[model samples]
Target: MTNRTMTRRDFGSKVITVSAAAAAASLAAPAVLGAAKARVVVIGGGAGGGTVARYVAKGSDDIAVTLINDSPTYSTCFFSNLYLGGFRSFESISHSYDTLAADYGIEVVIDRAAGLDGNGRTVTLANGDTLNYDKAVVAPGIDFKFDAIEGYGPDAVETMPHAWQAGAQAKNLKRQLLDMEDGGTFVICPPPNPFRCPPGPYERISMVAHYFKSYKPHSKIVVLDAKNKFSKQKLFEDGWARHFPDMIEWLPLDITGGVKAVDVASNTIITDDEKFQASVANVVPPQKAGQIAQDAGLADESGWCPIVPETLASLQVPNVHLVGDAIIPGDMPKSGFSANSQAKVCAQAILAELASKQAFKPRFRNTCWSLITTDDSIKVGANYEATEEKIAKIEGFVSQADESDEVRAQTAAEARAWYDAITADIFG
Candidate 1:
């Protein structure tokens, strides 16, 4: 991996028809009659919640907005893989909430949202304080299903290093790779479909392979996937064959015999058919909506929140909305771009619902980039529109198999540009 790119984390034009910040004059709520301005409380300051807080606050002078996050600073999961692959530093992917608070007039609360009283229209923080809200946007993102993988739970992360959450664990995974012997084997177990970043594990393999090839040539990598096929399957197969033949091996679900369990002490992943020993084991367990979403009673039996496509309003609870990997958004892969896009639409819907402004049609978009080797990247993306039923895919595109080196380099550049732009759009 090389020291590479940065830009906006999203692509395509955003069509917004929002009124001026003074649109709340037409608000039909009790706040319009000499009450405190309507309060909007956003939980989880990621691409989705942060953007919503900014957009809603930026759109209305009559809404007092507050963003609640567990952390003081936000670290993006989008480019954390680049950090693992040695392309970017840890600091590059981390962002602050100063701008979201100071510039957008949003009160950024550095505390976890422990409970939500939808009936009372209030969010209870872990700090024992309750904040009332006219509307609440819940974007707690994905939390790992540690119980899904036997012998690999929260206690085992320090050893096996799932690194899926992309913070200290990412640093831990990187350190493990650096400390391994020259010919040591690294094993990765990807979760089942509908997980965040469908192509993430494969890209991790690519980046890790790049690191091993450059520093430890004889090292080996094995992928024990939970699914039979994966996103960008052919493209990744082609890139692996071209760039690191004999260095990596991928066994699909039927062939890999589905992950049965693991032995964290021995760095071994036990399967239905065999056991894989490795110097490093990256076991990304299955995931579900963050705890707050589940605790708020917003999630269904699927452990994910269901939302109305147009407004992103929760189907389970009124005056509550969901976004990012927490929502079962139709036809949209869980990505930062998708979250950012959904937040924009969600903010508009909230604005309209809160202040009686006309809302625009909801459109969503997502593009995912993976680096195979130095200066070589593959991308897949799609455009979507919201119908009464779901968010339907309008069209899509992916990187071709037999592209030129110049074109691949250009694709890598495009990914870098997206990184720079999306981070700014989400953080600033």
Candidate 2:
């Protein structure tokens, strides 16, 4: 089937169908006051939770869906680097939940989920309301380990912003970059392995370089990497060399001997071999699943939720599903695309188990695109299938360093188009 942009009319049609089916189901059931409807509570409102809630509510009238998120509006982390680079505006990435509630009949709650009782199948909201659920989906994104690097914590984010979660943090980082002196040096300390968005730090460096090349021409960027190699390294290096020559420097752990600590007040990063100072210090610390997951006993010793790959059901908690950055996805990188894909498969599985429908074969796909410059982009993508052991990668594609200019431009356009389509799919 060909993918087309969903219009307001399409959404209206879906709403009508859903309402009619729900009415019919209610009338046909013998139980009183929604006893027949299966309750599903989604514990996040970003890509994974929003998509799952929308799909479950739209696909089945017999299921009652409630989506709980802490914020009134969602700002996507996926395109935040572009906003930092001045390629996009903050308003463009922000989305509202009005449509999800009004159109899809999802009960949208703008409150933090304070606790989860898996045994009792209840979720406790911050306001002291305990809601019961037949099944729950937790898609809460990454939480930073503030103390992973000594002397670095949430209080120091103002001086050295991670901005990994987007919104105000991203804006702050952009403001810092804009205020830096012309010849100043900017430093970024990427997080260790098994964090959200594997290629994000490199993409950020590219975007920062793009900004420095245009506004602060004399400014430079230095990457203090925790890992020796990174995703799409050659493509990023080539783009940096070609577009922002001599403006970006990457230091691997082997060279810098890994970061020991950070001095936010002095704007310095301490490594074994050297102490580097910078005008801006963007330190992305190590990460774990959102705190609510850990509190709910959904996470294991690895600090990530373990799930059955085919169904996305929590290994520790029955009738609960884990998606997005919170789950251990094996070969799949923690990305919005991966989360959205996993949500669909999970929604289908939930519907099959509750609504007595046949389960569909599960297949997941993810593509991460990085903008090197304005209209210069590259991408890495893969298709996966669930095995007895894990979700295994089957086929993959990547943009090459030697690709032609036309191809790179087309790739950038594709990236922008994807952002539009995906946000619409998730938010609408």
Candidate 3:
């Protein structure tokens, strides 16, 4: 099958994407309830939750949307690598919910969701406030499984920053790199499969390499992987060889024995066959659904919430829907683009169910872009359709290894434009 690539350009950079007929029918709230407003409570405020809450609020006037989150501003994980590489700043990637509140009339509650009563349709907050809702969206994102790695947990976070959550930890990792000596070694330990941003760890390696090559020319990078291979493996290997040369050395589990333990106090990674010392260590452990999701009984034994493919309705919780990394998205790779796409499909489903709007066929799309060097980038993407069981990919595209300089530069430009466009699409 031919690779078909769809982007924000295809939909004019719109956030809520539904068929035209269905969109027309959903412009206004249906006059089912004379004066009563349906309540929608959204937990989480990253790409998925922010987009869904905004889309649903814009879908109808007779709907009251309340967005509950622990943080006032959300720092995105999508472009944090660029910050590490010195291409972007932390402030540039962070976003706030002011627009969703001031313009879209979404009640942005900056408080943690302490408890969820799915059967009662009530959400309890950390401040002891309870909210009743007709529908709820659970996009709380991922929480690290600290116990996955021996001798590593919350206590070790400050020393060996995971930086996966992309906020203060990201800053901490960047600071550690800046503080290290010229010839010091920086170690990165990536988690196993089914983690957020499948290609993220590799991208971090690339960005860090870019940083070291410029400032600390003698600095070295070592990767300790739990898996044998990674997403865009060939592309990453090619980039590392061409750009960094001898500066990077990757050790797969079979070669390194395995990631047995770590000593954060000394920044030492103790594998079965060897012990590696580092000036700084980034250990991204295994992850599960965020704590609130688990407390809400949204996750199954697999530690992920399973949702109906068509509606994104939580299989475990009635009247509650989930999107983003916390959910078991079959073909999706837990990316911001995937979460943003899923949120649109979910918003349309919510309108159809609660506001009596025509239902549209759900189409999901995702693209992950990684920067290799200045004005050079590669991307892999696929479009998905919802089935009875899973979101199955229809077609996909990837940047060719032998692409011309102009093409790679164009790909990088596309990524930057996408970040700007998507942030606008979600926040506005």
Candidate 4:
């Protein structure tokens, strides 16, 4: 994969060379740079990748960071549910990497990573160019297992949008909602356990129901859930009855077979007991680490990359760290907040490693919010501690499982505030 040339579309603009004077002027305090400059290659410039690049570049002057992603702009999946529910526009979730390159001095490359040779510390891009690095951080996010369900693949998504990754799919789903007539059925199939954002499916249903209340009051949402219990279930259930009474219906795994098959053209979903046809269907398939991670030999048979808890460095490969949805941090939900928290810990560890210092102890946190309706939200949050082999949940840190009017109101307010704060941490 070496010696590959990059086209204009592949690499975007060439690196903006900064003179020694400019570089020196931009340097942080003397204490920040504890070692000689080292090149850090970060693959995937989304929530995790972008945060790591910024932190590494801003945490010390001695690190030259480069972020490689397939897209020039990233639209977050965190707040994307709101977009699908028609509460926010697509522009609100979309973000550019220009600021990361120019303001933070990160070399941004809009190229897909084809493979990683961790032993050699080199990453091969889709265009065949190979990037050598002192250390590499990978946060390639989630990939759908289309085959997990019968008659469903990338092609099926065109008619029935999952909108799981946001961007175009989000728009597609939104358009479908608008096209639906009154009294139409909107089917939502949430995947099995251990997927990105445990509370996301419930939140999505809430948002969609919110739209129905005003525009299509007779319309209903049928949730075909693969799990018996979900994050903040009681809160979401209560909010649904309170706000959109009878508009939202949930079919647990016992009755639905968790949506085993789908006929997109016919809008038919085959369940255990019977088949269902809907005007619109959103099928969130089972997921693993992104294909790039699996292709790079980072993923094990479990479809996730495992890492040393303290540094997030791959246990299979030295000097290469895996973060975000790609890595299986035990007991942690794959959410943007988890990725951001892990990125900060990863940055600290990388800085220590660059200076030939002891690894920094890593602590991770995640707070996931679900909108039960426009005015009501439920939340689940946790903090974690890293051991030598695995990351475990810290005692006494968990989301409220019970339902209360006061708690729901507080969560709704905090959800909006958290979105603003987290986005600022990544883009601002």
Candidate 3 contains a number of clashing pairs equal to 0
Report the Cα RMSD per candidate: 7.5, 7.0, 8.5, 6.1
Ranking of all predicted structures according to lDDT, beginning with the best and ending with the worst: 3, 2, 1, 4
Per-residue lDDT of model 3, residues 169-201, tens digit only = 999999999999999999999998889999999
| Model 1 local distance difference test score | 0.85
- Clashing residue pairs in candidate 2 are none
Per-candidate TM equals: 0.93, 0.92, 0.92, 0.89
User: Residues 269-365, candidate 1, lDDT per residue (tens digit)?
Assistant: 9998799998999988898999999999999998999899999999999889888989998999998899999999999998887755578888899
Residue-level error in angstroms, candidate 2, position 189: 0.5
User: How much is the lDDT of residue 206 in candidate 1?
Assistant: 92
Indicate the residue-level lDDT of 117 in model 1.
94
Model 3: pairs clashing at backbone N, Cα or C within 3 Å: none
Report every candidate's CA lDDT: 0.85, 0.87, 0.88, 0.81
Q: Candidate 2, after superposition: displacement of residue 313 in Å? A: 0.3
lDDT of 2 by residue, 355-386 (tens): 66568789999999999998899999999998
What global local distance difference test value does model 3 have? 0.88
Indicate the TM-score of model 3: 0.92
What is the RMSD of candidate 3?
A: 8.5
Off by over 4 Å in 2: 1-34
